[model samples]
Target: MAEKQIVEQVLAAPSRYVQGKGAIESLGARLSEIGSTPLLVADDVVWGIVEEPLRRGFEEAGLPVTRVGFDSYATAAAVDELVEAIGSGGHDVIAGVGGGSVIDAAKAAGHLAGIRWASVPTAASSDAPTSALSVIYTAEGAFEEYRFFPKNPDLVLMDTQLVAGAPERFLIGGIGDALATWVEARATARAFAGTMVGDRPTRTGTALAKLSWEILWEHALDALEAVRSNTVTPALEAVTEANTLLSGLGFESGGLAAAHAIHNGLTAAPQTHGLTHGEKVNIGTLTQLVLEGAPARDIEDFIVFTTRVGLPNTLTEIGLSPQDTAELRAVAEAATAPGETIHNMPFPVTADAVLDALTTIEAISRRVRAAHGLAEPTPILTP
Candidate 1:
C-alpha cells in the first residue's frame, strides 16, 4: 500500500514462460538450450497415454533418453525412488509428463539431480511445472514444507490432446486453483497495508493475478461442461491455461493466502488422504471467502458453481466424515498459524474463526447434497 511496501514486492523473481496447443514439441530443443538430456519422468498412467509420441519425439531429435516411473506425485518416497533410478539410469535431462504430481516429481528430481528439466502436463491441474517452488510431502503423503528455487523449468510444454483426454475433474480442480490466486492475493495486499512484512506483491503481480481470476470466472462453467463432454472447446483450453499457467505464476510471484492454508490442512486429516490438491483447495477457497466475511450471496454462488462442476464442495465430498469433528477442528486450528494462510487474510485470523467457517461449510455442503437427493453419497471422493 505504501511506496516502501510496493518496492519490496517488486523484488520477487519469475522465470521463462510459454504455452499453447503444440508447445510440447519444442521441449527437445529447449532441453538442448539448458544442456539437459532426455530423462523422462511420468506416472504409470501417462505411459499408456502418450509414451510412444514422446519417445518418438526425442528419438527424432536424436537425443539420448532415459525413463523413470512413479506410483504417485512427487512425494518424498517417489523422489527418493527417482533419485535412485536416475543415479542408476544415468539420465542427464529430466522431463515431467503428466498432471501436477508427475510434473512436481520431475521438477524436484531434476533439481535434486542438479540437471536441467522440462515439463509436459497431460492435465491442466496446478502450476507445478512453471514455478520455481515445490510443495513437498512426506513419504506417506503428508505436507512437509515449501521448497523454493532460484529458477523455474528450463522448458515448459503442453499438448491439448493429452489434456483433453484427462478426466474432467482435473480441469475443474485446476480452475479452482487458478482462481484462488486473485482472491488470495487481494487479501494479502490488504493485510500488508501497514504491517511489518510490508507489501510483498507488486502491482504487476496483483494485476496479473486478478486478471487471471477474472478470466477463470468468465470461462470456468463452460470449460467444465466441455471437459465433462470430452470436447476441447476454445473456452476449455483458455481456462485451462489461465488456471495452470497464469494462476501458477500469480500465486508464486504475488503470494498466497488462506485458501492454500486450508488446502494444507488436508494433510492433518487421514479421512482426506485420497483428495487431490485442487479438490481440497476448492473447498478451502470457499472457506477462505467465508473467513474473509465475503458476501453471503457470493459465497453461495461459488458453492453452487463449484458443486455443479463436481468440485469438492464439502468435507464429505473430499472423504472426511461429518463425524470427524475433532480432526476437522484440529486442522482448522493448525491452518490459522501466523506463517500459514492467516498472512493472506485481510485481518489477523483466529483458530476459532476457521473452525466456525469449517462448521458452516459442512451445513451448506450437506444442504446442497440434499437438494440433489444424492443420498448416502460415497463418504469419499476419488482424487
Candidate 2:
C-alpha cells in the first residue's frame, strides 16, 4: 500500500480581541497587562482623532507612553526606524493606531524587537490588524513585499464609535476584504492547499471563514448605512468583528487562493495605484469567481453585494481596459508568479486563465450595472 501523506492543520489569531464603543478607554490597562511601557505608532491624521482618549487612558493607568509617526505606507525603512525607536525608548510594547499601513508597521517593528503589540485601528479599512504578516509598500505607495512574524498580535482593540465616525467608505472597504475569506477558504480546502502557517486548513478555520461570509451577507449593508449616519449600530459591530477577527483568523488559517494573489498582481499596474487594497481585492474576488467557473448566480450575487456596498465590481472602475493589453498581461503574469497563492486553486491556474478572467469579470459587471440602471464608470487609465 502507498504511504499516506501526513498533512498538518494550523490556525492563527490574536491572543485577545476587544471591541465596542469607547474600547480605547481601556487601552492603557489592557496594554499594561502585556507590558508597562508602550510605544504608539500612528500618523498625524490618526493622532488627531485618537490622541485625547488614548493619552487620557494611558495617563489614568499611570503608564508612560511614547509616540512615533507613520504616514500612509508601511515601508521597510519605516519598520527599521520604528525598531530603532523601540530599542532607544526602552519600550516594552507597541500600540499601532491608524489604518492598515500604520498597524502593519507596528506589527513588523514589534516582531523585530521581540515585544508584543496591540492593534488599535481607527478605521475598519483592512484586515491587517490581527494577522501575523505585514504588507510592506514602497515609500511612493507601490507594493513592495510582505513581512511575516512567528506569531500574531498580543491584542486587538477596535473602538466602534471611532470606526462608525470615520467615512463609510472605510467600512465598505473592510467588507470587501472580509468577503473573500470564505471564497478563498473554500478554494483552499477543496485543493488541500497550505495556509499562511505552511499547513493545511483546520475544520475550525473553515468554519470561521464560513461564518465571516454569512455575517457579511447579513449585516454589511446595515453596517454601511449605520456608518453613513455615524452611528454604532449592532450591524456595524458585527461587521467590524467579521472584518477584523473572523476574516483575519479565516484567511490565515483557512488559506488564501486567488483573490489576494490577484490583488497583489493588480499592484503591478500603475493605473491601479490610486485604489485601496480592499477595492482591488473586491474586483480580484470577482475575477477569481470567473477563473474558477463559479455558478452564474454566485457571480451575480457577488456583484450585487459589492455594488450595493459602493465597492468596485469591475476592473474598469479602478483602471485598465482590454485595450491596455500589455498592463493587464503584466497583472496576470505577476498574479501567477511562482509561489503566489493563485496556485492554491483546486486545479492548476495559468496566466492566460487569470487574464481571461479579468476581462470576463468586466463584461459581467457591465451587465449587472446595466440591470441596476447604473452607468459604467469611464475607464480611468484609458489611452
Taking all chains together, each candidate's TM-score versus the true structure is: 0.88, 0.96
Candidate that scores best on lDDT:
2
> lDDT tens digits, residues 68-93, model 2?
88875788999999999999999989
Taken over the whole model, the C-alpha lDDT of each candidate is 0.72, 0.88
RMSD of each: 3.8, 2.0
Reference-based TM-score, model 1: 0.88
Model 2: lDDT equals 0.88
State how far residue 81 of model 2 sits from its true place (Å).
0.5
Task: Give the least accurate 10-residue stretch of model 2, judged by summed lDDT.
Answer: 374-383
The C-alpha stretches of model 1 lying farther than 4 A from their native spots are 1-7, 11-15, 84-91, 193-199, 321-323, 365-383
- Using TM-score as the measure, the top candidate is 2
